[model samples]
Target: MLKSALVFRNAFKILKTKYLPYTKELQKVGGALDDEDWDKIASFLPFRQIFYDSTLSFFGSRYVTGNTFVEEIYDIGYRINRSIDDLNDGVKSMARQMKMKFDKY
Candidate 1:
């Protein structure tokens, strides 16, 4: 019970520190976000690493005797998903900027 509670607490901390800033800033700026804004968004993660915070959060769950096939597959999928998410977010911001820039012409 305590472990679960601690996990939840840690998850919430990760959400606030690692996830919320980018989203909140995006919302706050509407579509006028700039490169500096994205840089600030990226800065939330340690060393700007993909899934660094999330992977650390699951440190206790890492394989002790080498990962099973299922674990290996899940890890692959998780990494792909994280990469896609990061790309998607950045692309969305860039798309907005492009649209706004072209609109002025």
Candidate 2:
């Protein structure tokens, strides 16, 4: 009852903000987005080219033809995805350890 209403309210708020599914605006002057900053941050995205404002909008769900999305929750999603590199590194280290053991045998 009350709990469900509260959950719904929170969900709506998130949809309105970070996880809006798509953004249709570009970086504005002295705003949250800019060329230099986009270069620094957007690289983490899978897109080889980055676009801003309305230049890349209206494509909806399949914008980049397999363009996956991150929840831009102030970088939480980014942080999680980035851990993949670290995980790969860990696996590589373990494989090296196993190879060493096998060589000893």
Candidate 3:
């Protein structure tokens, strides 16, 4: 019973991560700069192609160059996402193997 419960818990953890938010690239495309210097802002960001409209106005470049709150949040998001992905994969594999072993009985 304890093992089965643990398996269920593991399954839940994996499901959580597989459904986590993933939009760094998507959000970056809608930013405020057409990039007379694309390499400057986007080289660090996780994106392949950047798109900017005429209505966009480039900022004075603070998020990439300071200890700002937005930067902190972005850092936290990336860290949390990585850790959760690792944890989730382990849990899911464990759950699957446990179930498969039990099914033979």
The number of the candidate with the highest lDDT is 1
Ranking by lDDT: 1, 2, 3
Model 1 is weakest, by summed lDDT over 10 consecutive residues, at: 42-51
Model 2, 20-101: lDDT tens digits are 3422332233333333443433333332122232234424445543223332222333343343444345434544554455
Q: What TM-score does candidate 2 get on C-alpha atoms?
A: 0.19
The TM-score ranking, best first, is 1, 3, 2
The whole-model lDDT of each prediction reads: 0.47, 0.38, 0.37
How far is each candidate from the true structure, as Cα RMSD in Å?
A: 14.8, 19.1, 22.8
Output the better candidate (2/3) by TM-score: 3
Candidate 3, residue 36: the lDDT equals 32
Q: Which sections of candidate 3 miss by over 4 Å? A: 1-67, 87-105
lDDT of 1 by residue, 1-69 (tens): 333433355454455466766557666758333445545454333222433543554564665444444
Q: Could you tell which candidate, 1 or 3, scores higher by lDDT?
A: 1
Query: What's the residue-level lDDT of 61 in candidate 2?
Result: 42
Q: What's the TM-score of each model vs. the native?
A: 0.22, 0.19, 0.20
List, residue by residue over 29-55, the lDDT tens digit for candidate 3.
763222233333333232211112111
